[model samples]
Target: MEGKLRLAKKNLNISLKQKPASFQTSSPELTEMLGMKLAKWIKKHRVGCVVFLGPFGSGKTTMIRGVIKGLTGLNNITSPSFTIVNQYAKGKMNVYHFDFYRIKNATELESFGFSEYIDSGLLLIEWPEVAMEKIPPKSLKVTMEFLGLKRRKITIGFI
Candidate 1:
């Protein structure tokens, strides 16, 4: 099992050291599969937080949908853009998805108990560049950028 986990991490382009892992995906399905791969790791490792940085219309939400689907086996997922945050639950775990684009400052997070939320369950945040400093240093940071019309380069590693 350990060996398989290691292999999965490697194939998924995830690095634990200063060297970040990066890969390119041409389709949303591939991106979602990568999200699912990340889901397995986070669940097994009990990783509490993951932050996604990318431009608007990027695959952040799509990838998150994959994570939610993988974590809960619930295929229906939506962006928490206007809603701010969305919660999904499985047998014994919960996933909190937060979108911070509309917020003016990271301070707003404090009002909603964002810090406490991190400890409650797995958190997947989008448009977190503004809140980067507030995010825990131990959390995972994922950056996705466009490389072409339909291709995106994704890098994953610790914050």
Candidate 2:
């Protein structure tokens, strides 16, 4: 069982390296539009996890709000900074949004039933550096960087 599992994991990793998709958004509307496109891709691909990396005020939360709107048609969304996690339901699909900025260690993740959330629904993680080692191998990684006051360069790839 272990050998088969390892093989399957290896194959999945190899498959993810096919190509990466990237885009640049100069305004909040453009960022949200990109998020909506990502939402469609996520649903079509049945993506399980996504890790968001960006500096503070880089619009990570805004992108997430767009994703929620695309997935569940929910317009109101907020960052889970203090709360750590937020769960949303849209018919049969469940989205589990997590913020690890406050986490001190991997043990903290385990303490809060992080593993359970991974298997329960689609995961969108912000500030994943706190527990980078614990993130699943198949997760999609999104990196955002500010170009100017409102422009952002967003890159999406598997890592």
Candidate 3:
């Protein structure tokens, strides 16, 4: 088990070096697919941070919600737009989902100790443009763009 785990880690490191990013088909169905893929990937990594960026009305939040629903081990998923941050847990791992669309400044995020949360859990941040300066170095960036009323294009990258 230990050797397998080590080998997996080594392969992941090499893969990250060779191709640190991935893009997938986007739509309500594709969004769900991306979410499931992301969830599975996160399970292997155990923990990481991610940020989602998109213009208003883009389906960034929707894609995440779909992922949470499709992936059972992850805790119940809900939008944190009004609450600022929502936390879900699966076993020992935690996923902190945040929406800063209504937030204007870093100060608003400071009260939440946004830095600490970004470091601690698998952070999924929406409307990250408003708080780009606050994102941790390990955070992966996911950018979504509206392709149609019900479609989106999402690109995932490690930073």
Candidate 4:
């Protein structure tokens, strides 16, 4: 895990260097496929930080469910909304999912000690609006916007 984390820590990981990809997803399955595709880009020897910005019922959890499954073959991934943080791992590879919907600002988020783990594990943050600047420069930012009742325009890039 440390070796993998070290790779992204240096900003040399291939995922960080990816071209921006946009998806028009109207179904949960498609959204999850996008995440699964993302999982393949995160090489075995590299860690990652992904920030998700979207409204409620925007398929964030579904996408994360796929990412977790693709990354570690985990089948169950509940949103960490109330729990704040949820941890999952397969062997030495660890993934931490964090929800900041309840957080009000960067100062409040700092108390969670999230930044401490940014340098190591695969950290995925939902509702990270308040801590954008606090995240790593190489971090991937996924922004989801409503296009219709069941459609969303998701943009992925390094921010």
Candidate 5:
């Protein structure tokens, strides 16, 4: 485990070592490590809004699910593509998953109290380009890219 973590850390681009925490990952197990780190952040900071940007088939959804699985008691995590949004409860907090792929306009999210969700629940938005103008400026961004079959490079850009 230590060796894998060291390799993962070595492969990452340290943009802000001065900041509390940051990481970049290039393999599936390494990606899971990054998710664990973010899980710790969520536990410590209570983050509500997060945006994930990446090309198709880059495993963004997979990483998010891994994070949710690692989260204690967050058992109902699922892709929200069909319903547009899926809410999962973890103890007293709520995690809202949003998929904007089918959304023709940003206004479509407004009717569902998008601002209110951003204000209150932990939101994981996929295909966030459509509502990029509306998302909070401080939201954490995770971008993923295809490295090869069953391989991915995930970079976390925190704001």
Candidate 6:
């Protein structure tokens, strides 16, 4: 059943309803700008969750910093590596940033009541592979890949 669900998800063209977008960034500044653009889309759509897929130093955090700054106008964005999750408030909306890099399994996520946050606020998860099964099916997925030097290719779509 899970395999079928995965296959069906892969075949679904979410872009048909809402076009997917991609961006290339050669510096942290550009990456953050791209993230800010995505933030606007998320707010317009009232997106509840976003999953970020990328290796370390691929500028995932940098992009998230842009999103937070754009939405909340707070410049103190940082990775939640040690804390696991960080929450920020923007008016009535709350942004929950989660890093699953150190998580070993889904059970670890459940131990901290992860689902509650997903149900309540805008969620941005980094290294989502560690808890793929827990991610909401409707969540947007962003993939970042290193091209060369400081350049990164970011693809945004729904799955």
Clashing pairs in 2: none
Model 6 lDDT per residue over 1-159, tens place: 432333223322334377766666677877787777777778877778889998999988999998888788888998999999999997987899999898888788888778777678889999888777778777899899999988788888986
Q: Judged by lDDT relative to the true structure, which candidate is superior, 1 or 3?
A: 1
Q: Name the best candidate (by lDDT).
A: 1
lDDT of prediction 2: 0.79
TM-score of structure candidate 1:
0.87
Tens digits of per-residue lDDT for model 2 on 66-106? 78788999876888999999989989979988999998888
> Lowest summed lDDT over 10 consecutive residues: which window, candidate 4?
3-12
lDDT of 5 by residue, 1-159 (tens): 653666455522324333423344456666665665566666565666778878776767666776676665565567788888887776876677888888877677676666777677778899988788888766778878776775666666664
By lDDT, the candidates rank as 1, 6, 2, 4, 5, 3
Of 2 and 5, the candidate ranking higher by lDDT: 2
Give the TM-score of each candidate. Answer: 0.87, 0.86, 0.76, 0.83, 0.78, 0.87
Comparing 1 and 6 by lDDT, which wins? 1
Q: In model 1, which runs have C-alpha deviations exceeding 4 angstroms? A: 1-10, 13-15
Highest TM-score model number: 1
Query: Per-residue error at 98 for model 2, in Å?
Result: 0.8
What shift in Å separates residue 18 of candidate 2 from its native position after superposition?
Answer: 3.3
lDDT of 1 at 51: 97
C-alpha lDDT score of every prediction, in listed order? 0.82, 0.79, 0.66, 0.78, 0.68, 0.81
Off by over 4 Å in 3: 1-15, 18-26, 70-76
Q: Which stretches of candidate 6 lie over 4 Å from their true place?
A: 1-19
Question: Clashing residue pairs in candidate 5, if any?
Answer: none
